[model samples]
Target: MHLTTRQLFLSHVVLLAGSSASALAAPASKTVSLSYIARLYSMRTSVSGKKVVMKNKWNNIEVETNSRRAWVNGVMVWLHHPCRKAGGGWAIRELDFKKGIDPILRSYAYVPTKKPNMVVLDPGHGGKDPGAVGTRKVYEKKAVLSIANRVKAHLEAKKIPVRMTRTTDVYLTLNQRSDYAAKVGADLFVSIHADSAEASSANGVETFTMTAAGCDSSNYYGQSGDKSTKRGNQYDAANAVLGFSIQSNLVKMSKRSDRGLRRARFAVLKNAPCPAALVECGFLSNPEEEALMIDPNYREAVARGISNGILGYITLVNRARK
Candidate 1:
């Protein structure tokens, strides 16, 4: 799909919605029709086979019937629950609308009241925990720490106060990371790490926010039955905005395959004191990405991507305040 320059710009506008609160309060067991969403956004809707497509001059949303997969503006986003048939129409769960779609579509209503005063950066793994080990002895912990330091430099250059959970090769538990962020009064938290999989072909970058309450994680793909709520669920909307920002910038800067924004219930995210996102830079198990992780230039690119993402989110919040 081709997008004009104006359309691209419109996709980034963080506008407000009038009935966001009521829409968010819809029951978890209930579903919202795609037609309603189209009307809310002033977009036209059509059905082609199993997919429902909604589009305006500026943006487009495509959702598969009876599936959790969706695409917004050509970017794939995983919904918390699958879309299903409701009254002869396709609909998604209320939680998915509140935590996933609405925030991405209208972030101004979801942003924090104040601009972020401080950002806490957590580099995954440390001394005792090697994280994912790749070819040529490349370590995920070391790579992420280097990247985090670079990101700190970029953010600090822009006069943004930044702090890290650990500066060196020291192991810290997940609880300690979240606790430290809370103690420091962080307005935003970002955890960085590389991924690993048995299949070396699994490559690309993805960002994760806290999974909504009473929903399965993106990784589980609706298989898990865990529906427990977490403290981080309070920032579900903000998480989506932040995650989308990070993933969008990261993919643009790294020029990597877009794995889309996703959701998970990691300890750091589930207990985060503020809006948070966890970024998987790339898969260490993939030979190509593993090599790229060890390169200084590549690391710089990734850092710039993450820093720009944070700045983008801050800009949205500042705009919302105005």
Candidate 2:
């Protein structure tokens, strides 16, 4: 029987999930060896101090021994658990490999099987809600809207359909933003924002996806807060793929510090109607980053990064369809 694109995609997701259940449930003793991963990807492996570097012709992965930090093509991606020494070698939890590295490396197996029909770009905060106010008086809402507009332009140039939660300066509650995405049948949703912190030293580019069921969020509050599953957990695997794609290209294009692909239970992410990610362009509290936010050239670069990341995800979906 011939299946529609959506049906085929659902079937593929089920098959993939079932096939990996055993591996995912494996005990700590059965953690995946870095050596095995290197061999699987045909990458040469070497140890440098406390880190292991795996390099292939096309990609490179660096895992910090006994740490949750890892880098793929120089973009930092946090692991669910720290790499540990098992069976006389460094290995990572199976979930980390499946949900983090593998998805980014082999996205065709994890991303949606159908190309996205519509991508919703959410420029977070507006109108009465100015979001983070930089030291230079740059507003997060304005910066993100400008950046989102540029991103929409880039995607449209490639013939990809795009929608915005708010095209102009207007306050939108978190629920309203997500509801709009659902109403418009958004295949993928991205919320853009500028971060802020009391410590001016905190500055970087990061991407957040919904926290997986029973996993602690990467942020401090989440470590002590709820770890319960949410609606977005249904797309956990795909979120990893999309989140990593955005973080990777965003860091490369923005030339910002790699704060790593992170996990959070933000309202927009948790309530998303489809696979989604939130991009923190930079910290508005930091003088340097705040200045960059107001720079036209910087905004253009960030926009390109976000657009490229979405295009990369679309490419993966197309490849999966074939």
Candidate 3:
């Protein structure tokens, strides 16, 4: 199923909206970022005779289609914005593919599945950024990249199309990464990183959503008299849903100390157009955790944990939509 550039771009724009970094102006109003366009292009797949489903982990948007028109269940929901090209094509935006669209389709609505979308993986703190340095002199950028590569390998082995924000030790501005993701129309965005703490005892794994609405800085008590601060805006709520689900799944799989889900207005989450999450695999500042992270075997476990979290969220989202 070969896709034209326009169809590919449209799907990515929708997917990327969930995870794309903020500050991208409307498409027609400003120059579209090339990376954004590239991302949209990267996730494109041929849909002919292939099954396509979409789930908005944030909105519980589920929709499925065989071909031609899309249906929520039996009912047809019109596209918010119809594609002018491809003979007046329609697309389902960042929503759950099967379940989210199920109820609507059950209502006898038109549902169409154009193509299968791809996911985006980002390894944080690369090149000049260097992210957070660990007490062991481990570079956050290099460590995250290693983890990200492992993740890419695992996903590809499953035949799930994947893209990396940076496959090498190159530097990319937050906006550039976000804009590119927006353009790519990624279904989901996962940014990998190693955590650092002021105290070595502060070791654990944490996942983050953009933030919950109306709650900028809620102080949650931690074990060491530390207050957990979660921050974001209303725009981040959906991603927050995705974050919690992913974080929970990660804890269950890795058996790591659950730092729980946090909210930080990081560029990766704040500006993303689609649901996005940043994972602090473990505290590099902690000698035990840092030593483990440096090991190839442990890194594989971390990647497996991350992958499980993502697939778990996807599964839950699909089930909920149903």
Candidate 4:
């Protein structure tokens, strides 16, 4: 009742062809692990069932299976695809590694930053614009101003040279902020705000760099066909370097959820004159995080984390230059 050898061989060939066609129809993804990545870059790593932690002299990464999230240094980053189990351990899609993770790692360790000094800090929403509202009526604009002021103090204290679009409570349009940054010849621009969502359960620290050419933004519906460069497009690599530097520092020290690096085209960032990013420090709607943001001490910690991230980025740039 068994088929002859020739018949069996023909059946196998048909199965192989079908499998190949199925693979071709879907997004291509190859399983990869921390050790594999570490080997490629000569990094030291440790592994557990759910997480892969990699470290070198200058950076760190934490990848978790099925989490759709990873931590590079201290910054929490969202993966394009969740890690999958392979060979009895956690692994990431090859495409995600190459496009999402590798670029960030390389820039952190090697990219030469154009700006050694001159930073423009924009505290998001002021005066008429309260941005997000939280329990106890905590206005996001007020909290952000506090954080931005502290960040400014820290940067200036470090001799990095600082300027803010608005020194006092008043409304500055996104165009005004971007224009002022250009007028002052900024080397970098950082816009800081707290986040809010309809889902109260959502809480975390997320950082956003401008959307790159031919890439969909963090917001899924962002179009991808426009390869033409925009003002912010010129510094895509630098934006990653700067964005991750601050993000890692914040997530590491703030001890809040690491929402991950994201892409957006906010007016301030889209028209920015230099490498720019927007920092969503935490969710204003989450009660626990809301309590923290409202506290002066906790807000200081947030500032410290962001300022340290900026310093870390500066260090990367300076080291690369040398």
Candidate 5:
């Protein structure tokens, strides 16, 4: 976490051209078991007769009815935000089941394409969701919207039709956003967010996909309260792959700290009909990075980084189709 300036610069270079996941898997001095995930299977819970099931393929994590929330390795996740303690249980205000979960059940599944079928751009933290707080008193929502607009403009220049969930500051319900993508038949969905951490030292760019379902039993986060099944795993795996490709490119193009790809049962990613990713541009909590993010030049760079990543995914898909 204590990265020197040179080290940070090196991380950027390697992020763009080196440090493949396999290479980063070099034996470590200490055992880094993922507690966030390991605790899911052991999680205490109460069941509502009502149940929701979710599958995310990126880290092969699946949640069935009565599932407890947890993070997935190789995926980016923020434990405290959106979901916070309510009563004796945890609930994410941004992901209320009524608006978020039900939509996934009714939405269409997206097929992979050489070119994106349609691109759905989500500017994170509309309405009451302030997203991450920054060091210079900057709000995550404002910075992301700037980047999202630029990304939209650039994509449109490429003749790629783009749809924005919220073009202005208006609050749109999570269901409405997801439904919009499904309605438009978008091929890919990208939600823009800025990262913040307790430590200002945590500056970086990362992308996230849906959690994978087939994690080894040992890897289960403590979600003991849930029932499990195979059909869920199949659904999660297919989508996770698409999420992975976008995230991999996102990390590469940004050339920031490799937060590594992550999986979570997020509303936007979970409900979007096509491959979707939520990208954290960088940590606005860091003083230096906060200044950078506020600058128009740096904001443009952030937009370009996201656009490049998407284009890379598009090229990969097109090549595979041949």
Candidate 6:
């Protein structure tokens, strides 16, 4: 689980620059085996429902049975083609196994681009939108705003330039929030929120970045075959890097259920002008987690985790650029 600086779990490859026409047209050149993949990567795997969970010394991942989407470590990734059902097991096409998963896994070797100076922090909800209602009757809007402010304070102490979409309790549409970040020319867009679900046992922290174009979403809300591209698709690599950085630290520092990084078509992230991620700090529906969320120290720790993530991402980008 450790490496030299921003070291990653997978091998490395030089990203080929140019068109993907041949890649798109490439047929399933070979049948790839799941067990082979696990053996090759030195990982162990177990299956539950349609998900296969694999873990190794360096990382863990959950891949779906017949889907190209996989959660690698703390980021959602597209495998380009669906995994095939093979003798009641799962296997992926060699095309995506080589071109899609290989390239992406290699890119995880973190590198820096340039000094990212401006960051835009967005508190998920305000005023009319209470977001999630906790079992303790806590409101998500207030909690996220508090968390965002604490994150800002920590980042400012590091001498990083930071800004907020809203400094006070106010309602801002998703469009407005993203537009404000674009207007300010932010290097990163961080949307903070609390999660809730009918299942009270569902408790954990997860981060989401936009699903790349031409790929199925990780959670699979039936967005398969979505070929239309969006502005946010341009930062797919950066989004994964940033989201993994945040989710990794958050899960480690909070000691909460590791929900893993996810992908979604959030309104605020769909057109984001820069690398963007939406963070679900915790599940308010769970009473225990809600109590932790209400604690100032817990919020500070969460903020510290987020702050560390951004700094890590900045380091990665700056190093990559060099």
What TM-score would each prediction reach against the true structure? 0.89, 0.89, 0.59, 0.76, 0.59, 0.76
lDDT of 1 by residue, 1-322 (tens): 4579778665544232243545444546778899999999999998888889999998899998888889888777888788999998888987788778888888898988988999999999998999999977899999999999999999999999999999999999999999999999999999999999999999999999998887778998656656687888889999999998899889988888998899999999999999999999999999999999999998999999999999999999998899
Alpha carbon deviation, residue 236, candidate 1 (Å) = 0.7
Model 6, residue 81: displacement in angstroms? 6.9
Clash counts for the predictions, in order = 0, 0, 62, 3, 26, 10
Window of ten residues with lowest summed lDDT in model 3: 107-116
lDDT (CA) for every model shown?
A: 0.91, 0.91, 0.58, 0.81, 0.59, 0.78
The global Cα lDDT (0 to 1) of model 2 is 0.91
Q: Could you tell which candidate, 2 or 3, scores higher by lDDT? A: 2
Report the CA-based lDDT of candidate 6 relative to the real structure: 0.78
Over 4 Å off, model 2: 1-30
Evaluated at residue 131, the lDDT of candidate 3 is 83
Candidate 1 lDDT: 0.91
RMSD of each: 10.8, 6.0, 17.2, 10.8, 19.4, 9.7
Cα lDDT tens digits for candidate 4, 1-322:
3579889988877887787765444444655775788888777888767777888888788888677778777567766566777887668866567555776777654354465678999999999999999987888998999999999999989899999998777998889999999999898899999999999999989899877554556666546555455899777777777888888788877888777888777788789988888999898899888888889888998999899988888877777776
lDDT of 4 at 124: 92
Candidate 2, after superposition: displacement of residue 132 in Å? 0.9
Model 6 C-alpha lDDT per residue in residues 1-322, reported as the tens digit of each score = 5674335323321122234434434433356778877877788999878888888988776788777667677555555467778766688876445433443454445323556889999999898889999867999999999999999998899899999999888999999999999999999999999999899999888888887665556666566555467888777767777877888788877778777667777888788989889999999999998998899988988888888888888876666665
lDDT of 2 by residue, 1-322 (tens): 5469889988887887788756445533347999999999999999888889999999999999988889898889888778999988999987788778998898888887767999999999999999999888999999999999999999999999999999999999999999999999999999999999999999999999997766777775337666677878888889998998899899999999989999888999999999999999999999999999999999999999999999988888998999
State in Å the error of residue 302, model 3: 1.2
